[model samples]
Target: MKKNGNREEFNREKLLKGIVRSAEKRPVSMDAITNLVDRVENKLRSLGENEVSSQQIGEYVMEDLVNLDEIAYIRFASVYRQFKDMSVFYKELKEIMEKDKKKNQDQDHSGDK
Candidate 1:
């Protein structure tokens, strides 16, 4: 269901198109975007629920996008999350950066051994 409480069928093509729009002009490839869509669809199906909310789908998208492409993630986030102000948007960016920094640090240490 949407935030407006309207129920609709989940469209894989629609999801793919939105990701494409967000990832446009970026280094992200169609293969990566398609895999993200496939993963999200698989996750939703695994839920075994009759219906899922748009918010849930958005979260799923963000989860994968964050790892796929930061710019596209931010773009998708600004729309999916509807940031009310710059502060909120900045906060989100900071969080993503922090996560990325930690990920890099972990990889660095793993290679040190």
Candidate 2:
């Protein structure tokens, strides 16, 4: 068990190192980087809110910081929201999934019905 924990930590460290190298090679612009970080932060922070700002979302995407996109965002948001019960957590998950599916479905259609 301890060995597995060590392995996981090592893997995380290696992944972080790779991200740092990539960051160093082509430094992300401050404006873009700030936006992405903000998205990741806000997406993880806010809950019970109906809308997220477009500029903030764009900033997060431009920075390439939200690598996990919806999953990571959802995980982070769940913890941040402090879910009172499994039901609440699952409800949030379903809402997010439904929203994503609806978005994809809309994209498939050329025009509004």
Candidate 3:
């Protein structure tokens, strides 16, 4: 477990760095993202919730090929939460949209006055 944890942490870091590199038009490598995701999933299972770090998740999502601007964290949560069906996925998605809507509304109101 410790070995896997170390590997996962490393992969997570690499993925984040890879994203930054790729955003700069540098080469993006799949090996890095695959290793990162594999390690993260394993860690999430083996380590459980409290053990899984936000940095790790952020790094995994920031992978070079991930296209961060085109993807939302909710998308990751869908797969990570392992939704049993479309309904469950949509429910989670609705919540996210609502939150974003509220945030935008607040910003608009604030800007008006």
lDDT of 2 at 40: 54
lDDT of 2 by residue, 5-111 (tens): 32111132333333333344344444544455555555535644444443443344423543435554454445445679999989877977887788889898857
Write the residue-wise lDDT of candidate 1 on 26-109 in tens digits. 999999999999999999999999999989999999999988999999999998899999999999999998998999999989
Over the stretch 23-92, how does candidate 3's per-residue lDDT look in tens digits? 3443434565466466656756775554555555654554422343223344445444567999997886
Q: Tell me each candidate's TM-score.
A: 0.94, 0.42, 0.43
TM-score, structure 1 vs. true = 0.94
**Count of residue pairs whose backbone atoms collide, per candidate:** 0, 3, 0
Computed on alpha carbons, the lDDT of every model, listed in order, comes to 0.95, 0.49, 0.53
- Residue 14 CA displacement from its true place in model 1, Å: 1.2
Ranked by lDDT, top first: 1, 3, 2
Worst 10 residues of 2 by lDDT: 1-10
Error of 2 at 85 (Å): 1.1
TM-score of candidate 3 relative to the true fold: 0.43
Which ranges in model 3 have alpha carbons more than 4 Å from their true place?
A: 1-10, 13-70
Scanning candidate 3 in windows of ten residues, the lowest lDDT window is 63-72
